[model samples]
Target chain A: MTTKMFDRIALIGIGLIGSSIARVIRREGLAGEIIISTRRAETLARAEELGLGDRYEQSAAEAVKDADLVIVSVPVGASGAVAKEIASSLKPGAILTDVGSTKASVIAQMEPYVPSNVHFIPGHPIAGTERSGPDAGFAELFQNRWCILTPLPGSDEAAVAKLADFWTACGSNIDTMDPNHHDMVLAIVSHLPHIIAYNIVGTADDLETVTKSEVIKYSASGFRDFTRLAASDPTMWRDVCLHNKDAILEMLARFSEDLASLQRAIRWGDGDKLFDMFTRTRAVRRSIIEAGQEVDAPDFGRIAVAKPAEASQGRD
Target chain B: MTTKMFDRIALIGIGLIGSSIARVIRREGLAGEIIISTRRAETLARAEELGLGDRYEQSAAEAVKDADLVIVSVPVGASGAVAKEIASSLKPGAILTDVGSTKASVIAQMEPYVPSNVHFIPGHPIAGTERSGPDAGFAELFQNRWCILTPLPGSDEAAVAKLADFWTACGSNIDTMDPNHHDMVLAIVSHLPHIIAYNIVGTADDLETVTKSEVIKYSASGFRDFTRLAASDPTMWRDVCLHNKDAILEMLARFSEDLASLQRAIRWGDGDKLFDMFTRTRAVRRSIIEAGQEVDAPDFGRIAVAKPAEASQGRD
Candidate 1:
């Protein structure tokens, strides 16, 4: 095992991301003691049952009492509450961070209550699946994914390095960015996509003419892809929508404006405009594949093509 | 093998769908002879090199001659032109169909040129990956997928039944609907999703604030899913947008309107509203999975979870 980064690490809100951190910390031996805490008693119980941590605390405050590292992994909207709860009990010189999607809001919510002696950094891991809860997480979720850290300008470099090292040990590539830029980047990459997916799925569900069965049955054509994102944890996404209001609105406005132009092109039968937009987007997917952000397999390698039991095999 | 369903099957457009048809037909022994054709001579040559058919012809008309079954798998906008070109050469009593996404437009385009004695059924197999072209085709492309047929009233029932049987042999479940209804269903299920995907990808591409490399690097959060659909064949999607203009416009209107309300909720910090919409959409995804239209795997089962080499097991 690698060297331990902290004597104790407190995980507040044991959801998918939090549980994943617990698993990875154990796997990598990053923390001497892991403390899991959640607002919901049942969730804490579930985490205990899953053996996610060395200690279980019903109070976020209690969880951070002796911890050298405290990571808030709750909904963005709950960051402030979690921060306020743990503020007084935080150990001096402890490094505080969050895995929220919106860095600016998380910082805004978390930084105020943090003790002057504690090093508070805001981080957003650009990794997740649509699944949520402790059960949905796995140790390898962060492998080959990005973890963006938005450290305050005056924060201690040693504290920041220690936190970055912890994430690197969890198998993520690290990038540091300004909080606002992180928010903007995430608004387009994460928030807008989830919002659009939820909106489209809701629209399809509300259709009067089309039956739900028909939509589900023919979903493989394109709709099922949106459904995967739409099925993501609602509470977490709602918090993102509420917390990252400005950037998400900006991205949404741009998206709608571009969509209007596309709609106009369709209305006027401007095939060239449609073709150009469609063609340009293909390169982005290729770039993503090239960047190792996506799997190179066709259809993300989801389908296993069935071969004929016996056939004249020389055809292809 | 299965009894031969036709004397000769002509595939007019050896792209993803057409080439898959060729592969499946060869595997199932559905046709005694397979004739492949494409507008591009290179595509025809590639299909021949892949041994996708017994005969490869650059002329759609030549490929359809003496063929008992002719499948035109071209972009929706090209349906009319292909129908016109192959009209004189189409064999009497032959079942002719085109696997185009927009059924009403395809039917309207191709029906005028179809000979009265030939059965011209419009079909769409709701199965494909982001990849296109002859090389991307596989025999199991249609396995467990829905194939919708929009047959004109007073069309030959025997020919329709035969075509349905052929698709079944190709591993597709069949559904018959009125052409207009099919268009509306596809507008929601297929067309709208692709349009939304294209629009979002275009919006991301045009962003000056976020670098393209950053977008590519951080895509796994959610943007990559949209990229997959947006990266689809440009020509085919362009045709879909142009051909199904009315239905697409209607769906787009609804999508935009719903998005506006969602945007407002975010602006007003209405977490309850956001949560409700997100929570409701999750059920639709569950329904799709239950209906066997989607895999019930988290993250689409794309990422294999890496297990710790040693850990206390039996947690689940």
Candidate 2:
């Protein structure tokens, strides 16, 4: 493990990303003492039960006091509130960063509250599962994942390097980009995909011709892949949608236009057009697999086991 | 293993599904001899090299000459031509089936050419990976997966039972439904998901705001999952879209309407609506997992591996 980079590191919002940070900090000995805090009492209690930190606090303001580094990990919508809550408590010269999905909105939300003496860098780890909450995190969560840091132009280089070191110790590869550019990239790669997944699942649920049970039964064919993203944390995703409206809307418009063209191809029996489009997309998956972004297994290497009793309900 | 279901089984179009059937039939001793055929010479040669069948033939007619069971596993659009090519050569009392995703269309395409003496039953196994071709097949591909049979109203009961038995021996649970209903069920569960995935990937590729390298680098966030389905067999999916046009179009309309509402919710910052829609979709995924239709593990149980050299190319 690396030598402790900070005497005390406070973690605000002990949800999936927060708890993951706690675990990694502890695993890598990145901080001499870690303080965990969240708004919800049960979540705080759960983190304590899991022994996720050296100390647990119910108040973010209390958690930040005396910390050399503070990482805020909350829903994007709540970043500003958390910043306001902990603004006065932030230690001078401390590096304060957030693990929110949207960087531009986060920088805007927290920058006003951050003390001029403090170094506030906005970051996002482009990695997650469908699950949420304290129990859903592990030290290995960030391994091989990209953690993008969108630092302001005038930010202190030394503090940025320190924070980058902490993340590097946690097993992430770092990339730095402009906050607005980060938002646009994530809009297509993350936010839009989740939105599309949620929309499709909602459509299937509301279908009058096809029963819900049929959708569930036959999901393995293809639909289940979309469901994984749709089942992500609702509050977090809702906040993302609200915070990154322009980028998400722009990406969504492009997606719809493309869908209309594909729909026309199917309707008009344009097999060549469909074939060419489908063929071109295959290379993207290959590149992802080759880049080590995706697993190189069919169906994500899912193994079929005996059917559960619930499976019988859907069968005729 | 079960008693030999047929003296000889002819598999036409030895791609993912066809070669998989060949492997399972060999594994289970379901047929005394297996004959594989495809219009493409290289695929037939590869199937032979893979030892997928006891005999190989370039002509579908020759392949089914003395086969007691015949499975046409080509694209749905090719069902008619394949059926016509092998019709006169099909053995008396032989059971003929196709594993096409779209049932009504396949039946309509092939039923007119089937001889009165040959039993024609249209079947669809709701199992596959994004990977295709002979190299992608596996013996256990159908294990515990649902296989639906949509036989004609007056199809011989014994013939249907025998085909069902053959699938059972290959480790599938059987469900029988009307061809039209099967088409509708599949439209929402399989066709729409593939179409949406293909559309989104195409959109990302065509984006001017976000570079292709950025999308590939940040894909693990969510976009990577869609790419797997998007990268599926172009000919097969194209045929599915064209053949199941009515059901697909109907589902697409519903999907577009739901997406519009979701887009509005995002535009209006309707957190409650977004949260409710997102929350309801989680239950569908849970049900699928409970029904043994999907793996319960997070991120499809993918293990994070060391980043490959190619991954560095996309980084700034």
Candidate 3:
């Protein structure tokens, strides 16, 4: 067994991300004790029933009183409120962080209330399935995934390193970037994809020409791919949109502009132009798969052609 | 062994769909003789090396000469030429069909060349992985999938029944509809999704703020989902765009207009509107999952949060 890294770890907002951290911390023995806290009484009760923590607190303030590591996993829009609530009760020299998707907004919201003695680092783990909630987490969610930390200027170096080490122990690779850069990168990769997916699914849902039944039945062709991202937690995504407006708007504008050009090509029957863009984008898919960020076994990744089974093999 | 249903079967394109038909036919013993032909000699040779057919021909005309069932699985744009090439050689009373994604344009292209003696029907199986090649086929590819057949006016009922039965035997449920309706259905479910996927992936590739490496590394968050569709066969998709122009452009116009409204909501921080759209889309995902068109597995398809493993269980 490994030595415990923290005497007490306090988890604020026990949702998918928070509960996942709880599971990994327990699995890795990263903390001597875990204190779980969330605003929802039912979710807290559920977490307690699941034995996700050694202690449960009904208030965020009470939860952080003696915690050496405090990780807030609430929606970004809620960051300021949670930060203020726990500010007076935070342990001195403890590392304080969050698992929000938008870094700049989260930092702006939480950094002000954090005590000078506390290390306030902004973080986003680029891992999660479409499911959300306290029950929708697993210890393996962070395996081979990336955890990005945006440390503010003059932040304690030892605290940042400790936070990074904690994430590494949870089976995540760590990268540190400027908060603004992290926001921009995430805007294009996560935020825009989810927004586009949501928008397209909404379009299909609102369609007058096609039946919803047809869309559902034939979704395997392509539409279902967008549906997975579109089905992500609404409250969390709405917070992401409101918090990262500038970067998301910029990415959305670019995506719409590119889509307009593609629509024009289709109207004019420009097959070559259409083919070039479609083919070039494939290199990025290959890059991601090679980088080990995507499943290579075709799990909607790229169904590598298995050998064609002949006469003696196949299901009826 | 199952009895052969046709004296001979001719497949005019040796790509993913066509090779899959060959594999399934061989596995099920549905054809006494399988004749495979493609314009590309390299692809034809690969099909032969894989023993995907009982016979091979360089000319599509030669392939169809004695065949009782001819399946034209070419790009929609090339449907006219293949139909013209093999029209004279098609056996009388034989069933002729094509597996292009767009049914209306394919009918327009191939109908004029079909002889009076042949039963010309258009079909599209709503299935496939991102991979495409003569080698990327399995008999199980069509299991539980939908295959829509668009029969022209005065089509022989017996022929349609035969074709439907063939697809059923190959492990697909068959639906027949008007050509225009099939095109419209496919536009929303298949064509628009591919275009949007290609567009977003293209948009991410051109971003100046987010490097390609950044996009690749953090893709698991959402971007990788779009890449799977974007990496699909470009030639097939370009034809889908060009041939299904009216319906595709219609969907795109609707999509862009809806996106503008969504954009406005985001710009104004209309959290309720954003939340409503995001929440509404989850129903569609749930419907698709319940329809069994999608994997119930969390595989990028909603991780159901396996019970969080404790210290006694889990990888380090």
Candidate 4:
């Protein structure tokens, strides 16, 4: 693992994930030279100020030229455009990947634009914070997180392994699945949560019954939990919703169906049903904690640290 | 300010809220004697072990005997029964109050049992964690939170003010609203969030398509945020659902409608609509932060300290 995985690694969008990769590449010496290209002039300037790359270019084509590895870490909706911008200049056999939320859409948007000479492997590093932009990223952002790669069928296995190794070096565990499965799983795990968060926050905003002041003052009661997800990069989430339409809709249908049943239980005063559903859900939280995906508290990733009382433990 | 708010304070149901009030009573010396009562023997013993009260009793009637103030901190469904148990034992001119989520239902259920000699006031402290039971309480649990009182018409203003004063000493801001309005507001802000979290987590749990391990491992992507609310006390949440049916239903219906619209937007690739919603919700988070109601993170209240990255405010 000497610092020379590739002679040049090009990052086409220096936002949260992109700048994060830049930091890790710099720290781990993963690439001899890091070329950064972003659409926004300010962002490019900021990345340069942050010393995020060895070379900064406004043109994606210029950044990708002669680069052995090129990662387009833009929003899913921009994948096609970025792919098209850099495709002609991509070096032969160069591995081109993306860090997008929706895989099927990213593949669909980017696949046709990728030249046959390049190894086009779509990827999603399931790591981020609510913040965005070049300054919001850090080298340790991907630590212990999951990165899923949806390489095309009949694609070179060696190329896929190489990308996986790159993510591994950046502190992520790698997993592979079909793009469709990835979309469905993500619809439930990532996309749905973000959508629900945005929806609930919107509902609160439109509320006339509860004064806006009251919603803000009493948010810690539970409403605030959704706010962080709700406050994520609007452009990115919008793209996620637009790109992963069918899977997201399917997940939303299932979610609404389950919600309707739960609502029925509440309406009928079915304590047993409510209790059963609530109790069962607790197990999933515990499993997530055991699997190291979540912390073992009702308020994870917050400023308050509550110690669990032994006597508070019940069967549920 | 000197902490002698009542001659004696009886807490009838030493769960999280009950024990929290008890802790505050002890810390502030607000009561000459703190009498704690719950139906469960184990909980009573645990409260005694924790020194949460000056006296521990299984009978609500016995606990209320000779007490000048009584706080019924129980599930909404149990409010009537607890009121009945302590009705005869309530001292004349005593201020009788309750900490129930659904103020309207609690008032309806318990109003009949409160004798004319006692001043009955219903209040809801908009603060809690997912954990419950006597041992899960702390004196500062209500600090900087909202404590809403929904008093019946023509109720004793002095008694209501005194209760408000007590909550203030425990570090909560006070708000007064109609009982039905309080329930509706709570339905949207708290009840619905819990229900949705429980429902979504349940749906993910029942998915046969995605392996449980995959869901757990990738949960950090977003799904883990829902688990904290889903892991909240089952009995308390079940009672809330049953008692706050109308308000919860109203909010749930509205939530569903909004979600359907969002789904339609996603399906139609309406990125602008999604972006607008996401952007609007960010303002709510900002308001909550300014109101000091929430920490600036998704999984808040779980961690004692935020990462330094959160403090600097630059990353995504």
Candidate 1 TM-score to native: 0.95
What lDDT is reached at residue A37 by model 1?
92
Model 3 - which docking category? acceptable
Candidate 4 lDDT over B1-316, as tens digits, reads 4669898899998877898789788888898899999999998998898888888899989999989889998888898888888899999999998889998888888999889989998898888777678866667778888899988889999998999999998888999999988888888889888999998998888888888888898898789889889988898999998898999999999999999998888888887888888899878887887777765432321223333321122110
TM-score of 2: 0.95
DockQ each: 0.47, 0.52, 0.47, 0.47
Q: What share of the true interface contacts does each candidate keep?
A: 0.79, 0.73, 0.77, 0.75
After the best TM-score superposition of candidate 2, give how far the Cα of residue A110 lies from its true spot, in angstroms: 0.9
- Per-residue CA lDDT of model 3 for A1-316, tens digit only, reads 4758999999999988898899899999999999999999999998998788999999999999999999999989999999999999999989999999998888888888989998898899899878777877778789889999999999889989999999999999999999999999999999999998999999999988789999999998899989989988999999999999999999989988898899889889888999898899888988987898875444431222232222112111
Per-residue CA lDDT of model 2 for A1-316, tens digit only, reads 5578899999998877888789888888889999999999998998898899999999899999999999999999999999999999999999999999999999889999999999999999888778788877767778888999999989999998998888899899999999999999999999999999999999998888889989998898889999999889999999999999999999988899899999999889999999999999988988998887886667532652222232221210
Scanning candidate 4 chain B in windows of ten residues, the lowest lDDT window is B307-316
Question: What TM-score fits each model?
Answer: 0.95, 0.95, 0.95, 0.93
Error of 3 at B173 (Å): 0.7
* Model 1 lDDT tens row, B185-288: 99999999999999999999999999998899999999999999998999999999999999999999999999999999999999889999999998898888
DockQ of the two-chain complex in candidate 2: 0.52
> Which runs in model 3 stand beyond 4 Å of their true positions?
A300-316, B301-316
Q: Pairs clashing in candidate 2?
A: none
